[model samples]
Target: MAQQQWYKGAVIYQVYPRSFQDSNNDGIGDLKGIINRIDYIKSLGVDAIWISPFFKSPMKDFGYDISDYRDIDPLFGDLNDFDTLIEQAHARDIKIIIDQVLSHTSDQHQWFLDSRENTSNDKADWYVWAEAKQDGSAPNNWLSIFGGPAWQWEPRRGQYYLHNFLTEQPDLNFHNPDVRQAVLDNVEFWLKKGVDGFRLDAINFCYHDAQLRDNPAKPKDKRQGRGFSEDNPYAFQYHYYNNTQPENIEFMRDIRALLNQYPGTVSLGEISSEDSLATMAEYTEGGDKLHMGYSFELLTDDYSSEYIRTTVETLEQRMTEGWPCWAFSNHDVERVASRWSDNGEINPTQCKMLTALLASLRGSVCMYQGEELGLGEADVAFEDLQDPYGITFWPNFKGRDGCRTPMPWDDQHAQYAGFSSHKPWLPVDMAHKAQSVALQDADEHSILNAYREFMAWRKTHTILLEGDIEFIATAEPILAFYRTLGEQKMLCVFNLGATTASMPLPLSVVTEHNELSHHTGSVNQQLLTLPAFGCFYAQC
Candidate 1:
């Protein structure tokens, strides 16, 4: 078989730096701490590690609000430390992809600072700024995802600036040619520094309505959590004028052109749009845009055979040449084990089954830290909450802090669960402590061991790596599919329910490898009985 692309069916591990490890006893994870763990990460059989933002920021939205594009935040160590990390990660044959917040910058950023200083400044038009209406209201009916108006009044400029997120994170004006070039230069700066690629954060929000038109009010019945709260006024509008403008496409082409200069470099964009699947297809439709894009399709609380099959099939139909990266859990949403399974109490055998199912999917996969250990969400107390989003919507939405807790390294209930000498940023859960890496490392049947074994087994299957997926139509709770590439074909059958489900195959296709067995029983003839949450992979 011919060699496939570097990213085709590859597994990418996501590292939320603050919770990964702590170096210098600062109680916060830094670049050096990540460098020290490169060997451990490389052993996971993943192709790359996508580090969440480490750029200079005020931490208003964690690292998403960037104060400087070129420098490292002191909270994440110095530039030398980042350089050392790149060297170490590359030495282990692991590529490093840093998060790039391209849609906006912190209000504290020098460009925004200069733009707000005076209307006549050289950088005055670098950000989205508009004059208010006669009643001293915002230029449009746009709303911020963090609540309140999307427009923040700037007294110096005597105008309201656009902010899709926190008021501190003012949106950049990609409509300006100069602004687009400046952002591309920031990407080239990192490329020259030996970075592999970037995970573009909110890449679709780079442009807005040029006319500054008012967004029509969205009906109450139609509103859902596409990043806006139902209680917040932001959820009342269609958001047509504020984001996902057509002007953004040209800018993507320019950015892709720059990345093309580096042979092996790739770009993965995060599309958090109202129609994420459609936007994902648009952003990755051609070779001149993103190499791969992921949406929040599988990150929701909905867990059914139909939901999973429909999502993959819909994207497969919409995306012709574009590639996709599928992820169930990240720093943003609740953990999958908790969201999909019954209150996160999935048995160990089921966890292995789920891991195998995810690894065998059609597209690339992203595995968050602690996922291999079957770690559930940390039940963070209200008093210990550090996330502004969670704090603003507390009692109802407990924020992302539950998923961003420190990684458990040891089984012993030591200080910070062996993560740091000082208190961790988020409290570690007692349940996670029991499932620590050290504890699972010794057990052969542990979730971590299963993940390692499955990943190793997956590396040898070319059909699973670059195969075409064809779903087998069946009743609810039984998801069956086949992955075929050239002459290699494998049938992947999964039982998503908690009871035995019998699936019959066509009699004519039965072969020597037709034996179907789960953790419960064996199969005979055309009937295959699958145990609760059981999975089987057979060569036919």
Candidate 2:
């Protein structure tokens, strides 16, 4: 038998550090806060915790626009506090996977500060710098994912610098060997600190077209791309020349070489390009690149079983030798419960069903914070909103602030769902209070407990984690698939609709797990019936 990799069957929990937990009675969550909750995360049975960026940042794009890669921001705590967190988490047997925003740096970063000063500086080539056209407009038609043009002209340097997101987040020029080495060195720093892996943020946007070519217009049907808004002008471009450069392959090799030295460490890239799925496939096509890559394909509003099956199958077919990571919710998009709901209301049954469905998939899994409690998008009003993207595209898009709210821990703790004694950075969704961790802990049937039970149960099924998946042909609302690894196989079925569904079965049940099966589900000989938002797991 081939030796198994630790991450192959691992489950990752993503935490937006600023909103996870707050210690020292501060309004914002800090590293100490995360340290206090280490035991709570340990109870989830997740293998690793992918903490979002807590590095030194001005909070322009939250921690995504990092000013320093090596230091922890004061709002999150100091380096010493983070060291304690790593120590405590390691003690609990939880691996740490930090969020690495390598594509861009905060405009305030010393590298960018020096690069923007003069074209002759040693750091001038560290960022994408281009001369403006004769009309004095942007060099090309590239637009920022936030709202306006991708190019920001620096008066001091007399050249436009590229920023795929907000102007404060300037794109890094990976074409510069020095820039690539610096990124690798920073990554190595974390590996030496005992981090198990890295979640590379916007990995494909590290390099852009050297010719400064204008992007062609995108077809009308293809509007949405990662963080770009439907109303934003950025949706009009195909984003071909601006990102997903071929040089990224070589850079990935360099990153992989560094990680291989750490032994057992892994790299998962977040790809956002014109053809993000294709980019994901290409980036992980060879073992030298990313160990796994996840795209925004499954994060959208599409919830039909057909769409889910097609997306996974398509990626599987396209990937020659790549492993894929699937996530339905993250800090960026709306909660999957709200986005995938049928009638615009949060259904706990549907929530439980999706949890089982996501876990039963073939690849590694990632569950966002508060998702275990079946929390939906927090309704942040205009006055309570903090996301710049939502603020820019108000009325049309409310921004990601709704999904970035603090996790509701307890109603009895304080005003902000036990997150902090002071006012929170973002408003807590009052609706989440009822489903808080304290309340759900006592209820065996609660989504919180269900997630725990399902995850614990899934660990026994090695086939479900590392097996090859083949989608079973079925009608709408009913998604069925078989996870097979040689003689070990498990047939998983889920009804994603509001109404009951039934289909004929071809496999016989060897053992049935009662804990995970919804009471509304049944299988008799050749017939299978499932209630609305029901599921059945049978070993064949």
Candidate 3:
């Protein structure tokens, strides 16, 4: 049999380009900035770096609204800079996975512009356009994720086009063979550029229901999850027809076929639907589809041992043929340190414990930038908010600006935290400076050092990386699982609470060696004792 793929259990670090660093003092990070910080990323011991969108865009929804799929945005850098970044990152043994927002493009894109011009235009059907209802309203009740109706009127075409996100981002018609080929050509462009893989953005949203069906209204209680607030109208619907269409499965096969031509290239899809876990499983299951898939399941306000176990186990049971990728935080949601902590405060121990738990999960991991320092969500004021989603929803949601703030590199660089010489697009939170890389590098017990140590240690354990996971039933605040591969078996347990807790030993195993040194827990006779937010790992 062929050997397991490199990305099967790899750790990927996500870099939000605009906030990672500002090499030119432009208050925004660029490709050059990522190249400058490539060594630092290497020090994290990650197998790859998944960069958020840096493609040419109108910046309406940041880089998620691509105007030119083949070019780099001038605000970030040119193709030369990207080539240099790829070279530098590969020199350090780190792979590059760029975000592919294939579901939509900025209204300013050539295809969208042409499609919007006239019904007879060559690209007229490239996007989802429909005739208005007799009452001159949107054809259906679909709503934009950014709020308001999903359909936007184009006077020239005299029809409303579908936009699942911002009105500026018109959904591409994957039903069009030309559109599918064009999107694949764009993917091939990046593949030829030598990127190791792609982090397919909204991969499940590529196709819409052909019948233009109206999404059923979700009851008030069921409307609160997947990063949408109860106040946002997008959360009011079941989101069935607008995304996760049945045809997306075949499109996934086409994408996988293209990647198969490029040996060692991988595809990691982002799936969010009414039942994201099941969709994630379906997208990654056949091996002819996505190599790995992740969802917003763990990246929610619900944080507990039971919740985590249920989420992981549910996917494990459903995903019998495909691998899963897990993440706790990303550029879109609140950082885990504050989101999971008591009273929204930063807890270094809890951060460490969560890191250990995530790494020990059954699949690969994606860690966002600044997670190593246990950074909390920043408090951006109303006037300072740049996220359109936050501006539309206001106080209750606050968009994603808090999590997109600049990374703190030097605690002593009081002005900009060493992120930029000038003011950043968003201000760096003062609380983050105290836990900067410069300060953490000097302290052995700091979250940054602990993360580095644990990641480095994790690389040596094959069982932890490629084993079959089986959860052991435990009470609240205590998560226990065993990872066994071949003749090797390792027990991973964590105390996710604030107080010390003990549980009967799941198995009779003496501690030959413990992987983490910063832990404050121990395994005693027929019992496992864990200090608050402590974790334990040992071979049986």
Error of 1 at 69 (Å): 1.0
Candidate 1 on 1-540: residue-level lDDT in tens? 222268888899999999998987788988888887787788788888999999999999999999999999998899899889988988887888889999899989999999998889999889999998999999978888887788999998899999999999999988888998899999999999998888998888899999988888889887766543456676677878788889888887887889889878888998877788998899888788888998878887767889889989889889888888988889998887776775458467666777778878898888999888888888999999998878888878888898899999877667677788988888888888888888888887788887887788788888888898889898878888988998877878888887888788655443333322222334688777788888767666
Candidate 1, position 509, lDDT: 41
Tens digit per residue, CA lDDT, model 3, 206-287: 9999999999999998887786666888888998898998899999999999999998899999988999889988998878
- State the lDDT of candidate 2 residue by residue for 1-540, as single tens digits: 122277886789998988999897778988888888888898888988999999999998899999999999889988889789889988987888999999899999999999999989999999999888899988888888898899898999999999999999999898899999998999998998989899999898888989988899988897865655677888888888888989888998898889989888888999888777788899987788889998788898888899999989998888869888899999899999899989878898888888888878878888999989899998999999888999999999999999999888986445898999889999888888888998998898898888888888888878877899999999998999999999987888889889989988875765474656443587777788899998887778
Question: Which residue runs does candidate 1 get wrong by more than 4 Å?
Answer: 1-4, 227-233, 344-346, 508-521
TM-score of each: 0.96, 0.97, 0.98
Write down the lDDT that model 3 would get: 0.91
- After superposition on all C-alphas, the RMSD of every candidate to the true structure, in Å, is 2.2, 1.6, 1.3
In model 3, the runs with Cα more than 4 Å from the true position are 1-4
Candidate-wise lDDT, in order: 0.84, 0.87, 0.91
lDDT of 1 at 416: 74
Q: Lowest-scoring 10 consecutive residues by lDDT in candidate 2?
A: 511-520
Q: Which candidate number would show the highest TM-score if scored against the true structure? A: 3
